[model samples]
Every structure is written in structure tokens, then in C-alpha cells.
Target chain A: MQIYLPIAELPISIFLVLGIGAAVGFISGMFGVGGGFLMTPLLIFIGIPPAVAVATETAQIAASSMTGAIAYWRRRALDFKLGGVLLAGGVVGTVLGVAFFNAMRRLGQLDLVITLSYITLLGSVGGLMLTESLKAMLSARKGISAPLGRAGHPWYFGLPLRMRFNRSKLYVSVLPLLFLAILIGFAGAVLGIGGGFLMVPALIYLFRVPTAVVVGTSLFQILFTMLAAIMLHAATNQSVDIILAMLLVFGGVFGAQFGARAGQNIRGDHFRLLLALIVLAVGVRFASEIVLRPDELFSLGLIEIRR
Target chain B: MRRAALALLACWWAAAARAETMVLSLSSHRVQITSTYTGAELVIFGVIDNERRSVTRQEPYDVVVTAAGPRASTVVRQKVRLGPIWMNLAQRKFADVPTTLAQISSRPIVQIASPDLRRRFGLGLDSILDPAGYDLIYDPTFRTALIRLQREAGLYRSEERGVTFITPSIFRAVVPVPATAPLGGYDVDVALFSGGVLLAREDTNFEVTKVGFEQAVAQAARQHPIWYGAATALMSVAFGWLATVIFRRD
Candidate 1:
């Protein structure tokens, strides 16, 4: 049933929203990741405003992550020191990201930038995951460990501003981390993503941070970054609807809890493969928009702006 | 006990014997009608006083204006409630509710459109009957016509609970005259009803007049391409972002 709520006056189909929440929650519980990569678009498809969707999604992520973080802390799985470092960088990155976001808005090209970035990043990550997972699955059927690539050493290593990351057991400089943080920050600000996908891989492959510490630290950084984003958007635009956020967050917390438990039981390779497929499907759908023409694109003026 | 009863009876008799009358006048008694979009406005003014004693309580009133013509009819209603004399008796727990005086004095002007006029302007069929839908088409022309009708309708007065009353109120109601509405001389009647009973009536004449600003803007917006383009572009960007976020993977 559709209901008019006083808070936002949004005509919400409560049943539909809850059902979507349950399904997404289940997936998120099974996977050790935020389901925003899926939920935001689904909301839009159902006619929620885009700005409302993104702002609400961030609020949902905050709640979900808080629940997971608490559970992990209770179980002694959290690495406080590692989480702290990431958070420090994340805060700085968020500040810079918000600045960039405002500048883009003034240019009236913020939307274009956000769209292009999502397409490129989602497309690449999805493709990579799919390929790697497929290969792993094929190799496992033959009773063989897939060949792993060694970390290649560059001949000239004269990069400046090196810093030691004790938890990762690496002596890499601070420069790369700063650069990576800045890029992630921009993505976070523009897309309202936590940038965990990018951070996780970078932490594992580049810094060689232990896999156990990776998820925990990344979640920590995301928590800080997302909070900053929520605050910035709220204070500047008054665009964050508390009602919408509350609904998504209510669903997300339980989803994350279930996902964490499921992650423990599932085989890592198989889980990764499923995630890869889901990502690839989303990527293709997004790319199709650019390739396909829409029906009845309307305009009121002489110079037509095609969307 | 006998003395107390006698005093109470005497007070009741005195209050009943002293009834007050108030006079209300409008600046313009007749207004020219125009396109569905325009009309003459009447300014209403009046006074109230108790014949026996100064009224300690403020009076409440309602104004209604209606128009009738061939093919369409419309009504505009405004209400005012004066503050009670006993307002200082308590801390005013119901501050949110408007006072009787406030309701009668000033109100958002109401617009009424004849069904034929609405159709002529392409206002669609549903808007004519639905209050919400009608509000969506509240153009300047309709508003002006409403104001004019209210001005011409003159003063209305009513009493509720005998002690509280309305004086010198104004109302306008619109009705469609038949296709044979007289070109130069149209007889307009104004009637006052209290407790649903006719208290007074007046007759006047009017001539219909031309279109206004709001109608023109709405027409231009509909015909212009640039406006549509801008609106679409904004919607796409908003929707596009939503699509990307929802489909993104961890």
C-alpha cells in the first residue's frame, strides 16, 4: 500500500521497500560488503529521487557497519591500531573530497563526472572479479591451486615520502597511501560509496596488509568517511532525509550481521565468484544506458539536451 | 437561595433583551466580470457592538462569494474568528487554533472557475470538481475573477449560539450564466443566509472583461522547448546517479 508520510511526504510502498530490504539484507549478510552497490539503483528504478537515495544509502551503510563493527569487536577480530591509521587518512581524504564535490557542483558538471566514474570503476572491477573467479573455479576443478603472480619489483624505486605501516609489515612510503586515499575520497564524495572495494584490493595487493586486518580496517575508514559525507550533505544542502535514512539503515544493520555470519560458512572462492557475477551484471546494465537510446526524450527549447 | 435564583433570572432577562446590530459595507457593490482569469474585487468593512453593554467577547464571521453563469459555477469562502474576551482568563492552551476574529479578517483569496471556462482554457475535466486539482490551476485570471466576485457580493452576517456573531463579512460565489447571458445588462443577485435561512438579498449588474499573467506563463511553458529540455536533463542526472549506486558491487 502507498502511504503519505509526514516526514518527507514520500509516497512509499511499505511492503515493497521492506521486501527489497529483506532480499538485499540477505545478500549483504552473505557477502562481506555494503549492498549500496545494488540498493541505490533499485530505489531509483522504483522512482525515489537520486539525491535522496544516495544520502539515505550512506546512512544505511553507517548503521550496518556499526553493527558489524560491534560484533567483530566483541569477538576480538578488530585490529584497533590498523583501523585507527586508516581512519586518520580517511578523515583528511573526506575533507578534500567534499571540497572537490562542491567545486564540481558549481561547474554544473558534477553529474557527468559521477556517472562516468561509476561506469568506469564498476565496469573494471566487475570484469576483473569475474575473470579471476572464473579462472579460480576452473583450476579448482582440476585439483590445482591457481598460479599466483609474485609482487613484481620495479628497477627504479625512488618514490618520495615513504612511511612504515606496522600492521601490514611493510615499509612503504606515505606518498602512495596519500595518493590512494585522495582518489578513494573523490570516489566516495561523488558516488556516496565507502570506497572499500578499492581500499581492500589496494591494501591486500599493494601494502600486503593481512587479510584478517583488511576488512576491519577498511570498514573503520568507511565509517569515518561516510559520517563526514552525511554531515557535509546535511549541513550544506539539507538534502539528507532522516526518514529515508532510517528505513534503509534499519534494513542494512540486520543484513550486515547475517552477511558476516554467512561469510564464515561459505567457501571463499565460491563466495567471490557469486559476488563477481553480481557485480558484472550490474556493470553491464549501467553501460547499456550509454549504448541504448531512450524513448520520448523530451525537451522544451531549441537546443536539445539529450539525457 | 430564593434571592440568588431571582438575581440569576434578572441577569438572563437583561442579556436576552439587549441584542446588538452591526453594519457592513463594501467599497464596490458591483464588479465587472472578465475572462475566466479576471474579475473585480470588493473591499469589505464592518463593525460590531452590543446594545446593552460593550461586547466583552470578540465576534466570529465567515465570508462566502459565489458566481453563476451559463455553463459554469464557482464559490469562494473565507472565515474569521475574533479573540474571546476571556482570552486572558487562561494561559491559552490552544494557541495553535486560529481565533474567530483572525478567521474573519484576513484569508487567502479563493478562486472559482466555471466548468465551461475551465474547459475552454484546457484546464482538463477533473480539475473542475476536485479542490486539490483546482488548486493546481490557480492562475491569476481565476484569482482575479474570484476577488471581483467577492467584492460585488457585498456584506454577509450570521450569529452562532446567539451570543457570538459575524458582522459585515464578504463572500463571492461564481455560477455560469446560460449561453444567452445578456450582453450589456446582467442581473446579479446577492443573498445572505444565517443558520441556512435567508436573512437578506440584493441585486446588481455586471459586464465580463479580459485574460491575465498566470495564464500566459503557463501557456508559454507548455509551448517552449528549452524549458522541457532543462527539466529532463535535471531528472536524468538525478536518476542516473541512483542507477549507478544501486548496481555497484562492494
Candidate 2:
């Protein structure tokens, strides 16, 4: 079946979009991560205009994260204080990101920036995760346990505005946490991601937050940040396709149920390894598109005619 | 059962002795874009009505039908390789170009009319896209790209054999509107030509609109943006929450 998207002003196969949503949802459920990083790229590949894809994906991320955040809140795993601080920083970052997005779109360079950022962000993150997982896997085969991460105060801890996060059991400066949250919010708005994949790792390794609360804290923050992105993108750009987002969320929510059940049989290290490979493959594919010579050097776009 | 398709116009030639009237009708005047909309084809039927008292001519008559969708400004960008990556470096803007244009003629437009006459009637795609209105210094490549791209996208087309004549004075043509065709009013012009001279022309218009839920949603987004955003957010939350409840019952 074919469906017309109002904001994108195009027709697309209904099954194709639903399938992408399901597949990405399955992977996100299995890995316990928000699938926006995967979804935005796939939507773009399937011929959705980048602006529409990004803004619409933000709305999906908000919906998807709501489920995870609700579960975490009920389980008492979320850190409200930390999540609140991150949200405070997220507001500032989202505003700046929305401004940057509008300007880049006007200059006709939004596609280039989006493509390059995916290459850089996904490439580095995927690479690091791959090596770390492989090392962890190898040592486990030898029956040698990996050492726990040692929490240490880096130079940033000495910065002003030092604050305490009782739940994470850390007393550190709020500067680093705020700065990281801002980056996450900015990426969520500009790149159409929940930033949980990036935020979880940063919280675990950089800030040395407790593993028990890291995922919950990030999910809580992502839910609100993406919600903020959806509203701002709608108001400023008028590019969000609610129908498209609803279809994706429907497929994803259904698929994730099966995926979570299936994931229980797999080992933790194997799960990480699989996710790393998928992430790296997406990055490689994007890199090749930029490097390879394309068949059509000419492209078409519409410019608003202001009176 | 359908309504009668007859829409008559008496377009008179200068000389009353040999004057001819053009009568035309369209298959449909309104196209609705429902969820199942794929594409549509409008078959235009027309005829040349001449008073039987006039002397019959040896030369046969030809009919040319052209349809243009609503106009909008367009930007065609060319990518140049910069530091190992291809990016849009140069762009040319064409203001108020037809979103879609389809031309159907009984014979090749070139064979039907002289170059001067063709240009005057705006018969070909090139003539329709007059480049004289460029805001910047003109370049032919951009115009070439515009036509090439639009043709490939099925937005612009011309078919010499698309129009067929059942009789010398009676004719019909088909205009293909792709699924991606924009929604708006469409103007169709039917011109009569004989021996490289313009005889008579008639014009008619149709509309493409969205009905049902599609229309409501589009209206909400444009008219009540803030409320639309809030409603979308709430609906998305409901979809998400509903999914969990249905699937994760444990």
C-alpha cells in the first residue's frame, strides 16, 4: 500500500516504512536503547526528506522513551535530581540546535551537515564500542574478569559549581553533567536521536555514574529532551509529520515486545558485539556515500518565495 | 452514471467567412487525493465546429493540448566535489514555474507549426520555461538540468502521438498526472492549428484537493500549529503506551 505524507509532500510505500520501524524497534528492544540513531538514517535512505525525517523521528523518540522511562520510574531506578539537571541543560541546547537547523536549511547545507555528523558521531562511537566489546569478550573466554571502572576525580571536578548527586553516590561539579546533557539535547534536536546510546556510555565511563541508574537516568532525560525537540521543530520548521511518527511508533512498540523476549536468551557480551557491528555498518554505509562518485550531480529543492 | 462532460466555447477566427468554433470537454474537473490515490489520467475530447456553408479546405486540422499545474518557485542545485566530498556549490533559481506540465499533440509540435508560431504559443517545454526572467546572469546548463530532472521525475512531459483524431475535425488527448504531482488548480489549453497558423484556442481548469481525514490533519497543522503539535505529542504518547500494554502483559 502507498501513503502520502502531508509535510514531506510525497508518496511512499506503507509497508517499507512500517518494516523499518519494526526492525529498528526490534534491535532497540533487544539492546535496551532508543532507536532514533538507527531510525533517522534509515528514513533518509528510504527517500523521506531529511528535514521531515529528523523532526518526525524526534517525535517517535519521545514516544519510545516514554515507555522505558515509565518502567524505570516504577522500578525506582531513575535519578530525578540528575535527570532534572540534564533537562535544564537540554532546554538551552535544544534552542540553539533549532536555531542552527533553521539557518542551515536556509543556506541549503543541512543535508551535508547531517550526513557529516552521522559519519563522525556514529563512526567514533561504533568504533570504540566494537573494540571494547571484543576485548571484554576475549578476556571472558580466558576466564579472566575485567576490572571494574575506578571512579576518579578528573580536572573538571575541580571546576566551580560543584554539586552532589546522592543517588549516583558522587560529589562532582555540575559543569560536566550540564555540558554533556547540552550536547545530547543538541544532537537529539539536530540529528533526530534520543541520544541514549551516547549518553549511557558517557554516564557509565566518563561521569562514573552507577550502572543500576545510568540507563534509567538517560531514558528519563531523553524522553523530555525529544519532546522538547518535537514541539520546537513543529513551531519553527513546521516539518514534523505526525502520521509518519505514529506509524513508526506503532510498528516499533509492537516489535519491541517480541525483541525483548528473544533477547533474554543471548549473553550480554554477544548482545553488545552484535549492536556494535550494526552501528559500525551503518556508519560505513554513510561514509561510502560521501566518498563515492554519484550518478546525478544535480539535485532539486524548493525555496520559499517571501513577498 | 456520470454527468455530461460538455463545455462549449466559440473561439472565432479573424475572417468570418472561414471562422471556426472550438468545443471541448474534460473527463474530470476535480481530483481527490485519498489514501489510495496513485495517479490520474485526464482524457480531453474536443472538435472543430465550422458552419457547413464555408468552403472545405484541402489541409487537415491539428489539435494540441497542454496542461499546467499550479506554479511555484524552484531551485536546481549542482554538486561540485570539494575536498573529497560532493556538495551543492552552485544553484539557479527559477521563479513561478509550473509544478507539472504535460503537452500532447496530434503530430510532432515542430511539424505542426513554425518555430515563430511555436514560440508564440508556448508549445514546447523549453518555451514554457523562458529563462529571460533569471535574477542572476543567465546560464543554459541550469535550464537544461531543470527540464532533464523534471522529465525524469514525471513532472514534465510531451508526447507527439498522445493526441489522436477520430475525424479531421474531432480529436482527443490524454494528460498523465503522476502520483507525486502537487495538489492545486490545473489549467489546460487546447489550441487548433492549420498550415503553421493559429486558428482558435480554448482553456479550462480543474482542481486537485484532499478530502476526509487527510484534509482535516493538513488544516490543523497549518491553522492551529501549537494545538496540532500538542495533539500529535499526546497521540504519540498514547500509541507508545498502548503498545506496551498490548504487547508486554507480563
**Can you give the lDDT of residue A75 in candidate 1?**
54
Per-residue alpha-carbon lDDT of candidate 1 for residues A92-151, written as tens digits (9 for 90 to 100): 777777677667655444544555566788888877777887888888999999755466
Clashing pairs in 2: none
Model 2 lDDT at residue B98: 87
Each candidate's fnat, listed in order, reads 0.00, 0.57
Against the reference, the lDDT scores of all candidates come to 0.49, 0.83
**RMSD for each of the candidates:** 21.6, 5.9
Give the runs in model 1 whose Cα sits over 4 Å from its true position.
A1-9, A75-77, A99-111, A152-158, A299-307, B1-250
What DockQ does each candidate score versus the true complex, computed on alpha carbons?
A: 0.02, 0.43
The sequence of per-residue lDDT tens digits that candidate 2 reaches over residues B1-250 is 1112211111233343346778999999998877777778988999788876375655778788999988888999988888998888998888878888999998899998876457656888887887432335556788889989999988899998898898877898888887777888999999887776667789998888888877777787877888878877887778777766765555
Error of 2 at A245 (Å): 1.5
Q: What is the lDDT of residue A153 in candidate 2?
A: 73
- Chain B TM, cand. 1: 0.23
Best by DockQ: 2
- TM values, all candidates: 0.53, 0.91
Worst 10 residues of 2 chain A by lDDT: A298-307
